[model samples]
Target chain A: MSWNVGVWIASLLTLAIYSFLYKDNPFYKVAENIFVGVSAGYWAVVLWFDFTWPNLFEPLINRGNVISLIPIIVGLMMFAPLIPKISWLVRIPLTFTMGVAMALVVTQRIQGEIFPQLQATFLPLAGVSPGVLISNLLIIIGVIATLIYFYFSKEHKGVLGFGAKLGIWFMMIAFGASFGYTVMARISLLIGRVYFLLHNWLGII
Target chain B: MKQTLPLFIVFGCGFFMIIAFFIPLGGFQDVSQTFENWYTGVIAFFVFVGILNLVRVNTERIQKRTRDWQYSIILLIFLGIMMVAGFFIGGREGRLFLYLFDNFYIPLGATMFSLLAFFVASAAFRAFRARTPEATLLLIAAVIVMIGRVPVGYWIWHGFPSLVEWVMNVPNTAAKRGILFGADLGLISMALRVLLGIERSYMGGGKE
Candidate 1:
C-alpha cells in the first residue's frame, strides 16, 4: 500500500472531525474553524481570478470600458456600512441586486420549472396499457388533490376536504421518501469514511 | 434620499431587465447583458466583504482573548496561508494549494458531513414514533423506503428494490411536482411584490 504524509494528515483530520460524535472537543472545534477559514479564503481567491479580473477589470483596463465602472462603484457602495455616515448608501445596491434577481427569477422559474412540469403531467390517458393507465391516473389524482390542499380561497368541505385529505397522504409519503433518501445519503458518507480508514490508512480492506 | 431613491433604482433596473427579455433589439439585450456582468462583479465584491467581516470578527475575538481565541489564531493562520498559496504561489493548480485542499479541506468537509449520519440516526429514532394517524403513515412509509433501499432488505426479500423504485417514481414524483407547482407560484407572486417595491424588507426592514 502506498502511504504519504498528506494521507496521514487527511486521516487524522477526518478522525478529528468525527470525534464530535462523542462530544464537543478541541479537535472538532479546530477542524471546524480551519474548514470555515480555508473555504472562505479559497472562494475569495476563486472569485477574484475567475470573475472580477476577467469579467470586470480586464474590460475596463484593456478596452477602456467606462460602463464597467458603474458596477464597481455600486459594489463599493456595499461597503458604506463600514462608514456610519454613509450606511444608507448600501441600500441602493441592495435594492438593485434584489430587484434584478426577483425580476429574472420570476420569468425564468415559470419558463423552466412551472411550464415544463405542467407539460410533463399531461400523460396520455387513452390507448395505453393497464399499468401505464393506473400510473397516469394516480399522477392526475395526486396532482389535483395536492393542489386542492394548498388552495386557501375557500374552506375545504365535503369533496374538497376529501381531496385535501388524500393530498396530505401523498405529501406525507413524499416527505417520508425524502427523509429515507437523506438517511441513505448520510450512511453512504459514513461508509466512505470507513472505507478510507480501512483501505487507505489501515491497509486492512 | 434614503427610501425613494433606492425604490426608483429598483424600479428602473427591475423593469428594464424584464422588458429587455421580451425585446429582440440589440441595444436592449446588450444593456441587459452588461448589467448582468456588472451584477456578477458586484457579487464577487460581496465575497471579499464577507471575508473581511470574518477576519474582523476573528481578529477582535483574538485581541480580546475570548473563549478559545487560540483557535481563532489557527483559523487566521490557515486563512492567510490559503490566500497566499492561491494568490502569490499560484491559483488552485499550485502544488501547495492542492495539497492543502485535498488533505485539509476535503477531509474536514467529508468528515463534517459524515458526522450527520450519527445525528440523523438519533433524530430518526425520535421522529419515527407513531403518535398520530398521519405520523403512523409517515413512519410506515419511511420504514418501507429505508428497508427497500438497502441490500439487506433485498436479501430478505428479492422484491424490496423494485418496491422502493415504484414508491419513489410514482407517489414521490407526483407529490414533489405538486409541491413545486404551488411553491413556484408563490415565489412568482413574492418576486412581483419585491419588483413592485411593495416588499422593501431587502433594504433592511419593513416596507418604506
Candidate 2:
C-alpha cells in the first residue's frame, strides 16, 4: 500500500479517538478497542518468538539441551490450571518462578531506585553559595516533614506534627511541578506524531 | 469477591519486592529473576482477561442499543481485525502489523499521553489562585523553580537559575525522600496485613 493510503487510514483512526474528548462515542471506542487488540496481539507474538520459541524450542530441539527442557516443562505446568483436577499443580511452577523473579528484581531495584536517591540527600551546605545552603537545608527539612505526613499508627505531636504538615505542603508542590513536567513530555510526543502526519506521511509540509 | 483480595496481593508483591533487596541471602538473585519473569507472564494473562471483560460488558451494552452502542460495534470490528492479524501473521510475516503499528498505534498513544498537557495547564491555573497562605507560598516556590529550570528565565533574572538549583537540590530532594520513606513504611504495613490474611486482594475475592 502507498504511504498516502496508510496515512489516510492512520489520520482517520486518530481523529476518531480525538473525537472522544467531546464525549464518549462509537468512533473513539473503535479506536480504543483496536489499540488494545493490536497491542495484546503484538505482545503475545513477541513473547512466543523471543522467549518460548528461541530459548526453549531451539535449545531442546536443535541442541538437545536437557536443562532447557526444565523451564519448558515448568512453564507448561501453567496450563495445569486449565485442568481442574490438576489446578493445584499450576501453583507450584507459578509460585516458584515468580518468587525467584521477584527476589531478583527487588535486589536490583533497591540499588537502582533507592541508593542513588539516598546518596543525593547527603548535600554539602558549605562551600556553596548562600542560596544553595538554604535550599539544601530546606531539602533535608522537607524530606523529614513529608515522611512524617505519611506516618500512621503514631500520633505526631509538637515538632513531629509540624514536620508532617510541612511534608504535605512539600508534596503538593512537588506534585504540581511533576504534573507540569509530565505535560511537556506528553505534548512533545504528540507534536512528533502530528509532524509525521503533516511532513513525513502526508508531505504537506 | 470484593476488591480487597487483589489489594492484599498488590501490597504483598510490593512488600516482598522491596524486602528481597535488603536480605542479600544466597540464591536470592536467581529466585528474584524468576519471580520477575513470572510477574510478566501473570500480567500478560490479565491483559487478556481484561479484554474478555470489556467485550462482555460492551456486547451487553450494544445488544441493548445503549445510548452510544454504535461505538461498541466499531470497537468490536477493529478489535477482531487486529486479533486476527496479530495471531496469524505477527513477525516479519506480519509486515501489515508493523505498518499499522507505525501509522496508527504510535500516533494514538501519543495523543492519549498528550492529554496531560491540557490537564496540567488547567491545574496550574487553579493552583495560582492562591486561596490560602500555603497556596501563595507554593505559587511563589513554583514560579521560582520554573524560571530556574529554563535558560531564558535565568537569563532575565540571572539569580533565578541558581535559586532554582537550590530549590530542587535541597528542598525538592529532601521532600521526595521523605515521601518515599513514608511510602515504604505504608507498603510494609499493608504487606503485613495481607500476609496475616487481613487484606486479601488477590484471591479473586473471597476477599479473605
Candidate 3:
C-alpha cells in the first residue's frame, strides 16, 4: 500500500466519524465538533467573499454607495441575538428574509413548480404507447385520489373513503420507493468512502 | 411600536416584491433588483450569526466544564485554525485552507452521512413490517424496488428493472404531485398570513 499524508489524514477523519456507528466516543465527538467548526468557518468565508464583499462592502467602499449601508446595518443587526437587551433587533433581518422569500416563492412557485407539474399531469393517452397510456391513467387516478386523501373538509365515509384508501396505497408505494432510493443514495456515499479508504489509503485495489 | 414596525416592514417588502415581479418596468425593476441584492447581503450575515451561536454554545459548555468539555476545546481550536487560514491566507483556494478542507472536512462530511447506511438498515427492518394491508403493500413495494434497482434483480429477471421503473414513474410521480399541490397551496396561504402580519409567531416572543 502507498499513500500520501493527505489521504492518511482524510482516512483517519473518515474512520473517526464512522466510529459513531459503533458507539459514541471521544474520537467521534472530536470529529463531529471539528466538522461543525470547519463547516461554519467555510460558510463564513463563502459569505464574506461571495455576498458581503461583492454586494455590500465593495460597493460602499468603491462607489460611495450609501444604499448598501442599509443591508449592512440590518445584516449586523442579525447578530443582535448575541446581546440580550437589543436581541429583538434581529427581527429586522429575519423579517426581511422571510418576507422576500415568501414574495419570491409565491410569485414563482405557480409558474416554476405547480403549473409545470399540473401541465405534465395532462398526458396524451391516445398518442402514447400502451405502457405510457397505462402509466398516464395511473398517474391521473393516483393524483386525484391522493388529493382526495389530503382533503379533510369532508367526513370521508363512502366514495371519498374509497378514494382516500386507494390514495393511501399509492402514497405508501411512493414512500416505499422513496425510502428505497434514499437507501441507494446513502450506500453510494458509503461506497465512495470505502473506495477512498481501499484504493487511496490502503492501495488494495 | 416594536411589533408593529416589524410587521409593516414585512408587509411592505413582501408586497413590493410581489408587485415588482409582475411590473417589470425599468426603474421599479432596478429598485427590486437592489432590494434583492440587499436581501442576499443580509442573508449572508446569517452565517456569522450561526457561527456566533455555535461559539457561544460551545464556549458556555467549556466554561461550565460540561460533559466532553475537552472536545469543545478541540472544536474551538479547529474553528480558530480554519477561520485564520480562511481570513488571513484566503478561503478554500489557499494552501492551508485547501489542505484542511480536503483532508478533514470533505471526508468527515461524507463519512458522517454515509453512517446513515447502517441506520437505514435498522429503520428498514422496523418499517417493513406487514401489519396492515397498507403496510403489506408498502413492504412489498419497498422490497421490489430495492431488489429491482440492483444487478442481482436484473440477473434474476430482466423484467424487474422495467417493473421498478414503471412503479417509480407512474404511481410515485402521481402521489408526489398530489402532495406537492396540496402542500404548496398550504404554503401560499401561510405565506399570505405571514405577509399580512397574521403569523407573528416568527417574531420570537409570540406577542402579536
TM-score, one value per model? 0.95, 0.73, 0.96
Q: Candidate 3 has which clashing residue pairs, if any?
A: none
Computed on C-alphas against the true complex, the DockQ of each candidate is 0.72, 0.31, 0.76
State in Å the error of residue B85, model 3: 1.6
Task: Give the native contact fraction of candidate 1.
Answer: 0.73
Q: Write the per-residue lDDT of candidate 3 for residues A1-205, one digit (tens) a residue.
A: 6558989888888888888888888888888889988888878887888888888899999999988899999899988876787888888898998899888889888779899999999988898899888889999999999999999999888999999999999999999888888888888899999999999999888
- Between candidates 1 and 3, the one scoring higher on lDDT is 3
Share of reference contacts kept by candidate 3: 0.74
Best by lDDT: 3
Best by TM-score: 3
- The DockQ ranking, best first, is 3, 1, 2
Count clashing residue pairs in model 2. Answer: 29
**Tens digit per residue, CA lDDT, model 2, A50-143:** 5566656676789996766666665666665556765555543444434444444444445665676677777898899986687777887787
lDDT of 1 by residue, B40-78 (tens): 778888888899999999999999999999999988999
- Which structure is stronger by TM-score: 2 or 3? 3
Model 3 alpha-carbon drift over 4 Å, by segment: B206-208
Per-residue alpha-carbon lDDT of candidate 2 for residues B39-74, written as tens digits (9 for 90 to 100)? 554444434545666677779989998877776676
